[model samples]
Target: MNIPNRKTGFFLVITGASFWGVGGTVAQKLFQEYAIDVNWLVTTRLLIAGLLLLTIQFFKKDRSQVLGVWKNWKVAMQLVIFGIFGMLAVQYTYMASINHGNAAVATLLQYLAPAMLIVYLLLRKQTMLTRLDVVTVSLALLGCFFLLTNGSLSQLSVPAPAIVWGILSAVALAFYTLYALPLLKQYDSLVIVGWAMVIGGFALSFIHQPWQVDITNLTVEASLYILFVIVFGTMIAFWFYIESLQSLSPKETSLLGSLEPLAAVLTTVFWLREPFGTIQWIGTACIIGMILILALNKSSSSKTSKSNKKPLRVS
Candidate 1:
């Protein structure tokens, strides 16, 4: 890759991840201040971003793939499964976590997906645990302990519901990362992700209609925040990150992706003034340390993971 392009890739990845982190905090503001429903926000974000992405793909080389993905019956079924379970589940659980707690905690909790994926691989005998993996897992557990409990085992710092939803979000993210590979290998990421979002949004509409949700408290500023979450957060963020992969290695992107949680934490604390305890900050460092270890050791990762070209698409 050209050096200039690599530099651009680093900038794009960081900007995209930062958008995601800030978007989460923005959503938290809407939820806390305006009492926006998580379901409605998820539904709206998916539909709009999905349509926008597909619109972009329509003018690109992968235009054919957009329609081609649904030509096969088995592929269609797989797409539906991925849309509802992978995309929808990940989005809903994450937003629910934010609604129940603050964005910093929720985002950090979701970062545990990589560790969860590693453990899943080990259980399947697809990958063996190394000393590094051991340290990674230990760090993840310890980090989560302090994050949720603030170094106190007897009491929880974050709400019970937030912790539950955040863990579920990680599970959903792991599933998304694992199952999305085959589709992404065959089709462009835009086509796969775009269609998945549309399918997920459509599926969710029957249960939670965005149009019916009360917007009486919606302000001009709130509308802009919502727009930012849908456009900058979902579409531009994913597009930029995917584009950056053309110039950067998966390992490099994974390492830099740490900025997402960092951005979320900083934005939540500084902008929203969410109170974070000292012990909780230590937990955040440990979690980030785990990500660094994982990325640095990517070369020694199992063949199964090496075949997987991308890292977890954390939001």
Candidate 2:
């Protein structure tokens, strides 16, 4: 098979990231209108997304490859983790954040995953903390504090539980990124994602008890919104993300992928007319700045290390 066009893949990555960002806004609308429980929304999203992608896999690729991976016990166990902790945890925590807080705030808090990853890496001794890392983390945390406080620290009126949920969501997202890296090395991207979604969906389904909900009574708009979550937000976006992983290094992919939260914030502001206070905007900018600094610092350090390793000609 021919390699995908890099430019095309990059474009798809950005598009997918943007869709992910905007997903909260879309979900928020459904939540308000249909009164859909967050758990049911998440379960339905994963099931529908999993089935749809499975169909695509059957048509576009060899089914045996996917089935073969599923049959592997070790890989299946990994998929279980991917589903439960990675997909399910991230989705549930994020939805909980949205339920407890507004979409914009929840979305911004979730973007703290990058900073969390840096901390996690440092803790694991996988990476060392440089001055730049410290400053970047500090900036990201300050931005988060601003968002939490809505810029007026004096008010400090944010709910404690909501803040905890937001932090949990960030942790889940960071773990998802870390866990996915190793799995991608060992499995076909789509197959790994498909099985993970299936497992995660079923797990969440049992937890959510979707059968208890009145599925037939859902209005057309609500039903369509759920379908949109399954189709555009989950299946298509995840497929593009996995495809991008095939082409880009993890750091490059993640750095470019920070566009998701920006997209979400913009979508909320423009489409929902969600109020964005000046303080909120400043916080958002700081968050983006921190991410940029981390990405650039990583890139520069990588380049310097490579240059230092070059062979010296004594002639």
Best by TM-score: 1
Write the residue-wise lDDT of candidate 1 on 1-315 in tens digits. Answer: 999999999999999989999999999999999777889999999999999889888996568888999999888899999999999999999999999999999999998987898788889998778887788888999999989999787899999999999999999998988888778768888888889999999999999988898787789989999999999999999888888898999888878878889999999999999999999999999999987887777654455356446443647
How far off is model 1, as Cα RMSD?
Answer: 1.4
Where in model 2 is the C-alpha error above 4 Å?
Answer: 1-7, 157-159, 244-253, 296-315
Kindly give the stretch of ten consecutive residues in candidate 1 with the minimal lDDT sum.
299-308
lDDT of each: 0.88, 0.71
Per-residue alpha-carbon lDDT of candidate 2 for residues 208-309, written as tens digits (9 for 90 to 100): 787778888888888887776778777888677656755665555656767877877887788878677777788888888886676555442322223211
TM-scores of the candidates are: 0.96, 0.85
Q: Report residue 94 deviation for candidate 1 (angstroms).
A: 0.3
Candidate maximizing lDDT: 1
* Residue pairs with backbone atoms closer than 3 Å in model 2 (clashes): none
Candidate 1, residue 286: lDDT: 93
